[model samples]
Target: MLVWLSLVLCYLAFLALALAMPRHHEQLRGRKPGRGLVWLLRITGAVLLGLSAWPALIWWGNPAVAVSSWLGILSVAAFAVAMMLTYASGWWRTTLAGAGTAAILLLVLPVFLHP
Candidate 1:
């Protein structure tokens, strides 16, 4: 589940970054998002990039596999994001918004719900 969820978040970040570009910007969010949304994309992209490090550091136990893991996650994330954005632009925005919310919740969940 974490894998799938992570994929969604990573892909969301990718899509956000793409939408930041003017050519594709209007295709996303039903309008050209203002500076705030662009900043959100950049910040969330950084956050998700950092989040990718989480699984890498945990599963690999150090700098050994971190790069590979991060790259692998990034590659898969980009591919999935491109496909979705190309074939399902209508659903992409809403799904990304929802998944982005879920991703942030998951990230902060332990802080609030931990024992």
Candidate 2:
């Protein structure tokens, strides 16, 4: 479950990074994002990508496995993001919203369920 959560985070992080580019932002929304929004997206994407590794570390406990798993998850997420951008650009907002909601739920559920 935590691994799956990490995948979602990676997906969202890629999505944010992709949207930070003016061309991609315009492709999806028909206008370039403002400079402030672009910077916000870039920083948020970086932080989320970093945080995505935490789940693997928490789940596997071995640094080697955690790093490798995170990279593997990142590969899958990056491919998914590319496909989405190529074929379903119009759905970006919806996809981001759903993933964000799911990530939040995943982060919270284990705490409540385990405790």
Candidate 3:
């Protein structure tokens, strides 16, 4: 239970970082990101979400394997890519809002359902 909670918390932190990427990128580059980059961020976010959920499914199937923990670690990498894409995109505000909301809901649902 503790490990799963930690994974969820880490994922939430990554989501927050991803949400801030756009504004940070703009300040660094002195220009807005392009539409293409926004799309990239969205795709990356989706991928991270998918990867993060995989571990829980695997844990259900086989708790003996250590692969689930590795998947959780990979989620951090996926979140980094998502953040980079968000920062590179000009549509940071919209993407951040959507992703943040989705992340919160995803993290909360399991707690209530499983508790």
Candidate 4:
């Protein structure tokens, strides 16, 4: 469906953003990024963003699905905000935590609200 496709695209964009963050940070600092950290950042960011956006596919169905879709959107937005903060300040941990929390909430909230 279109929702699923959009979710995929959003996640891929997040992945690219994640991969680029470290390089951006390094450039800001006039140095090279640590390779291990860059890989970790890219993988973690992609997983978190992908999971957060995954639920948006629920929008295609019932009220339960709608709720799930909304939650996904919320999580993705939160992750984006967190990423923006990291990009601006070069603080990675806090933003990563924010993204993780948002993703977890997206996975948990739907079950409680719908059932």
Candidate 5:
């Protein structure tokens, strides 16, 4: 679960970093964040990304297995978050709420449903 959570958080961090960019101001709210905000997003995103390895390491003893599993899970999680944010943002009150719900269901449902 931590692994999945980290991937989702990393994607969210990516979105934050993207929104912090000046080019995204119009799409976001016609407002650009200050340099400090942009730096915050960038640093936070990097830190969240780096933390994603913890769960993988705990689950797999081998470095190769841990990294490979992390990469695979990260790829799927990133796509799920990105797609939900891109299309659902216009449909819901908040993109994070919509995307997060979808991601939680996709990644977490099976764990409880079949366990």
Candidate 6:
């Protein structure tokens, strides 16, 4: 579903943005991230967050509802990411991998699965 995809992408975007910071990266990886890596994470996070809006536009086909839905999805995703960082920091790596795989699968599967 577009809603689910948007939520996952938003969550991933927030995770990437969080990990771009030195403290969070160090917390999760046990080492500071390089400048290049930080920049990459930042750009990737921004782009993914932007991409998450596409499904809403396609599904809703109305600017107002689409914008509101995207905002709601972002809020839920941000809260989920904050909770993960606060309470489940140890699982960051696993969560990142799983979310990345899920995002890819969601993007690809619909192409083949659509009637």
Point to the candidate with the largest lDDT: 2
How much lDDT does each candidate structure score?
A: 0.72, 0.95, 0.55, 0.55, 0.66, 0.93
Q: Where in model 2 is the C-alpha error above 4 Å?
A: none
RMSD of 3: 9.9
- Candidate with better lDDT, 1 vs 3: 1
TM-score of 1: 0.72
Q: What TM-score do all the candidates reach, one by one?
A: 0.72, 0.95, 0.35, 0.44, 0.66, 0.94
Model 4, position 79, has a per-residue lDDT of 74
What are the per-residue Cα lDDT tens digits for candidate 4 across 1-115? Answer: 4354434444444644544576655644556667786777677666655554444544455667765675676567547645664665464545445544554565566678885
lDDT tens per residue, model 5, 2-78: 56665666666566656566765345655778889878878876776676677678768789988998888778766
Off by over 4 Å in 3: 1-21, 27-30, 61-115
- lDDT against true structure, model 4: 0.55
Best by TM-score: 2
Instruction: Order the candidates by TM-score, highest first.
Output: 2, 6, 1, 5, 4, 3
Q: Write the per-residue lDDT of candidate 1 for residues 4-112, one digit (tens) a residue.
A: 4556667777876887766678876667778987888788777876776665566566676666766777899898778877898778757777877877776777578
Superior candidate under TM-score, 2 versus 6: 2
Worst 10-residue stretch by lDDT in candidate 6? 98-107
Clashing pairs in 3: 33-90
Off by over 4 Å in 6: none
Cα deviation of 94, candidate 5, in Å:
4.4
Per candidate, the number of residue pairs that clash is 0, 0, 1, 0, 0, 0
- lDDT (tens digit, per residue) of candidate 6 on 7-97: 8899999999999999999988899999999999999999999999998898899999999989999999999889999999998888888
lDDT of 5 at 61: 70
Q: Listing every candidate in turn, what is its Cα RMSD in Å to the true structure after a full C-alpha superposition?
A: 3.2, 1.0, 9.9, 7.3, 4.7, 1.1
Candidate 5: what lDDT?
0.66
lDDT of 4 at 56: 51
